[model samples]
Target chain A: MTYTAWILLTASLVGLSCGIIGVFLILRRMAMMADAISHTVLLGIVTAYLITRELSGVHMLVGAIIAGLLTAVLVQWFHSRGVQQDASIGVVFTTLFAIGVILIATQVGNVHLDVQHALMGEITFLPWNTIHLPVIGDIPKATLMLIVVFLVVLAFIIAFYKEWKITTFDAGLAASLGIPVVLMHYVFMTLVSITTVASFDAVGAIMVVAMLITPAAAAYLWTDRLSVMLVLSGAFGVISAIGGYYLAVWIDTSISGSMAFSTGILFLVSFIFSPNHGLMSRVVKPYTTTE
Target chain B: MSVLAVRDLSASYHKNKVLYDVDFEINQGSLTGIVGPNGAGKSTLLKVMLDLHPKLSGSVVFFGKNLSQTKTRIGYVPQRGSVDWDFPTNALDVVLMGLYGKIGWFKWPSKKDKALAMASLEKMGMADYANRQISQLSGGQQQRVFLARALVQDADLYFMDEPLVGVDAATESAIMETLKQLKENGKTVMVVHHDLLTVEEYFDHVMLLNKTIVKHGRTDETFTKENVQATYGGALRWMKEA
Candidate 1:
């Protein structure tokens, strides 16, 4: 209805999709790979924009998925060749991101591609880029794209929940059960790429990284059940998005940055105050038991 | 008929050869123990056989078919420590994974699967702890949980890597009893074991390995001190003298 509502809805959906996928990456110990995909997908976006001379979502999605898959492949290639995993991810992402930055500066300068906005998004301006449909005329394109991505991600999670759980927990056993672990891995990376692309305009690269990891990490501190953790992570992400929107409105700052800050705060609270695994529980257990 | 047949299986890690031309055939309904010293390729041989690791040269058949064709009939219990215990799942959830293959794609486990998993956990004395977070379990309890998971597979053949390592006496005996039960059901089981003293006591068939098969036959005939020395090499020659 309202512009602010649209922006907030898009932000919340972005956070929700990222947070859901973040749970798997966090469990698989591939949070760094998420970071890698978010950064490297920039190269794909820049490449697509340069060639098409249009900021079309389809081109961006295709390019981002390709680049993201390449990053995963190269990282695995390096790892298989004896390079350490984190190091491989570090090398691939930084190199591709650097190339993206250079391309943006030199080649895409004529386009309306602001480097600052690419790193830290301008969520306030998201409502300006609107698309008209039959009855629901004048909807923000970013909102529509993120809503679609969110639903697709949710469907993927529901359909493959068992496979994801098995593969993330024990890949060797998953393979032994004929679970096609490598195919699942690639599909997961592709989803990560899609989410990063969808959220790029709303949260930018840096904040996407925060949204992808922080809420899920916070949920992890709160629960030991995967099902509960997924629901809690989604709730945390939405809370961060809506709360950050108001905080941004009050402080007159970047909405994405404020949202990311809120996620960080939630994670810190969970880290200290979670009933089971928190630092406060650890510290209070001995005194309570003695008393 | 042999439940498992490995013909001239060779495997390497990086450039270093781990398993040399290893040949072995395991009969159906037998409990076999693979014993060797560290770096003797006991684990590698099993991994290579299951095609978990790439083989330099090998052909392994299970029940007259390739692994892919016979995967549904095979169950695996990886080393207890190999997985992340902090994973956000309870013992029951982990055990339920064994039923995923049978349940097939795009379908959730039904009440029957849960009941089956519960029964397997009960067999391992882990029924009461099914809902406990895996990370909170003791080392022995964790091992039992994994054993229960493998048991839920209801496989015709099972491969377990060091399932008894770090387990308590009670857990160890429970696992041994379960293995005996599996054999009684006419299921084939191959385990990578470390304890020399329990080799004869645990397995009906024993294969001593050191980059290759040094001795393999019925446990009573092949598990002599000399075979143990040969498997362990000069580092453990005192075993033979003793």
Candidate 2:
């Protein structure tokens, strides 16, 4: 029931969710798109607050999902038009984010969300906001959201393992097989959006991208199968989340940054040590006599 | 019966016309070679026939129904390089994709589906490479894997885009055998082929195309020098060995 314990619980759950969705982002080669989606959610948050003049968590989640879907659609449109896909994504999302920044600067006179808060999140301060559940007693609302999202993503992947795997591997092939490739793609981007927005309140904008990409990229080094990638990415995310929490506690700085740092370090380690794709592993392969 | 039909099919990319008023029909239990020179819209025609291109204007009918309605009755093997060969998936996993339409969403491949995929791999001489990552495959192995994927569809019609490109002679022979088998089983096999030399040997019917169909008939008739000249803009004469 300590604040520190609450922080660790929240970080671990959110990290788990990020890792789960990160697998698809990595598969789709949309790491930068995921980064763009995280930023655009800030705009959505600002726009929603301006319209409703309220700060409810659910409202922010809804707004963020809409903005996230829009960003994905824009990326697809540009890519299909024969434009350079990544640069178009960068241009579209950053423009929306700049608008959000200006809105927050000029319009929000009293809200606690400033540029600094959006960049470096406050996990230590998250424990005090109580959402009391009748069965579970008092828990941080962000922790509860993270748990729900993680379970939903886990169930979705488990249920649609064949469809997701096929689409990730070859979208045209999946479409030819009548698997509704476009619809599945939109559904995935929606989940990524939800994860990014949810993490916005916990890990902030920049660090959420780190969690979304790093764990999955690290898992990429380890496996060539969707099932294995999903499991390994989730594990990597959870470890980084816990490790980052402690590192932040020791360093006396931001918890989200520490989580991102830990994820980056894990990615580097996997890049070197992964059996099939790792640099050091390949270099050491000729000398090893096991084969 | 003609299992597939296309009428007045015109397609363009960014306002540049690729396929123009092209019409074709594919009967069941036949192998049709669609041959054309470079930039002759061979791939574009196949894509339009499969209803994959939205900019295409045409009617693609299968079994007397619209293309969308006949989706489950058709299998497609795109170009071997159309996707990232380095994608993190194995050969068996790729083959299993053909069963997705029949199995529907959120459903696992049944035991029968796995059996079918394995059988298809074995048919293509790729059963031993079932667990190997697709990128680890040679060009011929990659083509055979694609053929296996199509075979697992168990559909009435098959469309393969340059299935023999970059493949070794042995792989080419394997693919020809598989296509011949599909034809014998009463499936229509339409291949977007580039090489003219194999047209006489591999296909029973031929369509010589250069932005349009200049000739389509039995292979021996349609593979004549004049039709080949028209399809290749007189370039075929030089490429041919006397």
Candidate number with greatest DockQ: 1
The 10 consecutive residues of candidate 1 chain B with the worst lDDT sum are B233-242
Per-residue lDDT, model 1, residue A121, is 79
User: Relative to the unseen true structure, what is the C-alpha lDDT of residue A186 in candidate 1, on a scale of 0 to 100?
Assistant: 98
Model 2 Cα displacement at B64 (Å)?
0.5
Report the lDDT tens digits of candidate 1 across residue range A1-291: 888788879988987998899999899999999999999999999999988898877888999999999999999999988899999999999999999999999898777676787889778888998888898788888888898889989999999999999999998889999999999999999999999999999999889999999999999999989999999998899999999999998998879989999999999999999988899998878656511
Q: Global lDDT of each model? A: 0.91, 0.85
Q: What digit string (tens of lDDT, one per residue) describes model 2 on residues B126-190?
A: 89999998888899998898898898888898888999999999998988988898888888988
User: What residue runs in model 1 are displaced by over 4 Å at the alpha carbon?
Assistant: A285-291, B237-242
Tens-place lDDT digits, model 2, residues A52-166: 9877777787888888898889888888787788888988899889988999999998887787777667777788888989988998888877777777787887888888888
Query: Per-prediction TM-score, please?
Result: 0.97, 0.96
List runs of model 2 lying over 4 Å from the truth. Answer: A287-291
